[model samples]
Target: MSTEEFDPSRWDGRDLPYIPGEFSDPDGVALHDDYDADIDPVTYEVVRHSLWNINREAGETIQNLAVSPIALITRDFQTGILTESAEFVFFGQYLQYFSGTMDIFTKWIMENRAEDPGIEPGDMFLHNDPTVGTPHQPDVALVAPVFHEEKVFAWVSNLIHQNDVGGTVPGSFCPNAVDTYWDPPSIPPIKIVEGGEISTEKEDLYRRQSRTPQNLSMDLRAGIAANERAKGRIEELIEKYGATTVKGVMRRLNDSGQESIKETLSKIPDGTWRERAYQERSMTGDDGVYPLELTLTKEGDELTFSNEGTSEQAGAINQPFAAWRGTILSAANVLLQPEQMGATGGLVRQLNFRPEPRTITAPDHTAAVSPSGIYSNQVSLSMANSVISKMMLSSQDEEIRNGAMTPTSAQWQCHIGDGFTDDGEYFLAPMTNCMMGSTGATPKRDGRFANGHMWIPEARGPNTEEYEQSWPILYLYVKEHGDTGGAGERRGGNGGKICYTMHGGEMELGVYTTDAIPKTPGLFGGYPGSRGETVVLQDSDVKDRFAAGELPTDITEIDGENVETVGKGPAIELDDDGITEWWWAGCSGYGDPAHRDPELVATDVRQGGVTVETAESVYGVVLTDDGDVDGEATESRREALFEQRLDEATTVDDIVAGDEAVEAGGGD
Candidate 1:
């Protein structure tokens, strides 16, 4: 796993060893023009490794630097704070890099790469193109390259999911997208910084294009600051350990990471596991059903994922092949080896991916990929499910229920409009953070109610009050729906709630989300989670209540079941989706109800998450005169219910067929 081991066998003939017109291998020698070429190869390698390590460390530190004041933002790829040079587009999968605006980023790189003077040490580069180094256009990246003495050593990058970019719809993400030009938040290659200075012209231009300029500007600034900090740290490392040692450490880090992955591969039972999941047409618009198929192979210590047999969707579920491959690998490594971080590390070495074009994960650029962005998280969930159901199935874990790591996924969008304020001053703002869905629960714990994606650690909820104060929308309550989690011995997580009030302004609202519907399924007796929704609240009576002291906070009810009370408009059933109109939390449960502790079920009821009747019917546990469990009665009821549940499990196919027959006969 050293430079010597990097031979032609790994070559796919996709691209040559280096840029056709540029140097053979940019990483092989000193990149800065003023650097001396007489340095020994051994010394040069050491220097390269040191810089690479510096970049790696920086990457882990500044990854989720939320500077999107009112917008989505993140770092750039390949370019690190310590390895300043011309923009290196990587000329590969852009969406895989989690960057925003693929076409914009590629154009930026090409323009900057051609500059004779070249980008400087402290300069920050920005772009977001799937073809360049990102998955979709909404993800933005800020990158910097560090130089030492006179030689370029390493790179630093940060990635972020922006809420919106101009597109055909309010949310920058258009599931029906047919052309790249229709994509929102598409930022092309442009030097927002030069010699550590922010260009006013570039800033204004960028702000003008965004509906949420305030947040967009803030995120842009944050990305710049993060890169600057990365640059400072790299310089300090070089001054302390010298460039050679740092470079050596980086090379070792990558090699060591690869070795660790290979070892893990060796331990797995060697065989292919073929698994497939579906994104029903109900959730994917006119697009037919989309399938995610995998053939996992383990050859001694080498593991690969072959997606050759998967079919493609005509709708938005499709994604760029290269980016999809990287995303799948990322999900695999994240679940199996989270300890190994970095865009390039052990995960990249021990794995191989085969995503043939036209499949959902490997679609043409012109095809809609919004569904890919929405349902791609299933990759990680399914991989975790397969591994757990196989290797860990016999253990206490027993099933894949609660095996997924990603709790909630999101899709954010923004709308742009022109209008005058109450004071007559023209103003504009973009919408963000309006959509999110919870993930399936894990074996050990409940998935977080509504939360961020697995790849995003610190992607947190915005301060609602603060958002209202700064923007033209009134902040609503952000709460978790009870019983929204899947039911199991270990239940999955629930989703969060959001309510926004419109102020007197003309603007577009943004929505970014995944798993909004078509639940993140649970395994081995666990139920699937709930979907998400976006709604506009309109009612003068409700507004009047808010204006009075009667309602100080925003409130939105998430109805999971459609049963209505005699007095109350609709009896809120906080369980699974069943004729429920409001968006509820996810239903990610594990194990069977019979396995649940009677005491825990009682506590859940006491907390108002479940009704007393539901506990009695679902758990078959009775309450005593003293409000405690009637042990004798409960025992008898449990035995009877257990038998019934077992019987119900046996005739699931018949039940499904009966339901289909009833539906065909015009039954409710």
Candidate 2:
């Protein structure tokens, strides 16, 4: 698509930045920003920490109140507190990306809907429109304005991934989506709960598009309850400390976060860092590999990001501008200013996003964004993590460099089961075991194994027993897939693998994923980790073996013909006789594997985390039969590997000289 063919500004707040002011469309709503109270140091600390705790508790409220697997079990929900104008002040410990997107969603509400709908007291707005602001359509948000003396004092918001919103497929993730229209309905901010009461009509309207209406309906109440619970706490604090005093504390927290980040950035040298990643295949029945690149430029105390060289938005592998920027914000929060926890509003003030409007990283509203959360947006997460880590690594200050790490585990794989339960109830939910992704290797330590996703580090998906009860399948094994982490001075975390088969009911499994090939890059000289793929073993003997009282742990042990190996595209379904199995490698490494201590490699071999062949070829470590390091042999192998690498590589000096000579021969 051409840049001239698309205009992002026409579709609801698609291109607006969050700037504090009265509503342009609605003027009657009052904003209480009177920060005149003189709060003592002790009082300020008390109120500041109290607000943070409130946000944290609100997130837990969602977990307790909702029955959706993504909510109660997967814990994919996030809650946050924003200023009356929608600038994030405190974010809970959940999906870090939601904090950024919610800020955008609420600011859009203040800008556009405050008049017709009226942002009155007791009103709460719900939304999941990627154009208006959300990572994807499945993540629905509820925002309530905390009114103090009938003025908007603050806003409390929460969003959880619903089980199903109406789409061509179950789980609302259409990997084969033709466009955003083919995916779930994108609802902009609407009054889901009005005047402190559940609007039954609006709630019906909200869940009308979902395949699993009961699940989405309950999730609706979960979000509303979370926001109201948080709102009550905010009101109590305002009553106890006085609105002016509490507002002053919140302002100070923002100021502290801003100054802290500024000080950290000032310590680092000004420089630019760039990283590139690729996503294979756009939709089902297509074989296309597209590149996405991110460049970070830091000058003085501010940082700027650009996606200048990304490919044009295509198929399901595209994200809206809000999601693209949200990935950046999540990275900044974790790597740059983690000590200031959820103060992304302050962090964003020092950051600017300059995006090319037509690219996958900043697509127009017409692109299929539902799958972007699992695919392309994650590519953005990996790139931003790498560039920021590199930039932070350049700092002379040890404290600044302490925060640096390689690219995080940004890859994912999943199978959504759409089938009838043995008891006659129908179901549509993900296996969700894919949440146990590995973390990237850091400079001084190995990445933690099965640490879940990089975006929401806190989420550990439901247990195996829960999966069996919820779906019509039985898990053969859900174990760590060893030897998948990239080889380096410190190995990356290990990815997870699982095998399963049909048990008692009719079933159809929808496979949704991105591949492990052209893998997410490793930092320094470390090799990239393997990307994962999903495979179906059709008409397998695994079930027959189960009848014989023997279970299989290895995919190789299953005697079956491979039906199809799927990547990032349309999902393929399967019947009861077929078996499904898949695995993902850990995030990439942090340094040269050859530079690693030989003993460490041997230890990894002993633990089954590294294969003996990999130890020799990749790490140049020779291990004895007893899994001990063969020091003399290791020394010889390391020298040979180093020499072999030099022989296989082209010299940079030679290339640079050739370029110079070509420039000198301008006449020719």
* Candidate 2 clash figure, as a count: 2
Question: Can you write out model 2's per-residue Cα lDDT over 1-668, one digit (the tens) per residue?
Answer: 01223343444555332222322323667888888457898999899989999998898888888988877887888899998877778877788777768777887888778787888888999888887878888988889899988789999998898898877878888887888889899888888777888788878887888888999887888888888889999999988989999899888887778888899999888878888887777887778888888989898988888898889988888887777888888888988887886776677678777778768877777778787767877778888889998998888988777677767756656677687877888888676787776787777788766777667867986688988887778888888777778778877887878888888777776655547455578888877766776777878898789889998888888888786666654455666667878776677887899999887887788887888999998999998888899999999999999999989998667668755643222331
Best by lDDT: 2
- Model 1, 570: alpha-carbon shift in Å? 26
- CA lDDT, candidate 2, residue 52: 91
In candidate 1, how many Å is residue 107 off? Answer: 16
Question: Against the hidden reference, what TM-scores do the models get?
Answer: 0.71, 0.94
Query: For candidate 2, what is the TM-score?
Result: 0.94
For all predictions, the C-alpha RMSD in Å is 9.0, 4.0
How much is the lDDT of residue 607 in candidate 1?
A: 61
- CA lDDT, every model vs. true structure: 0.48, 0.79
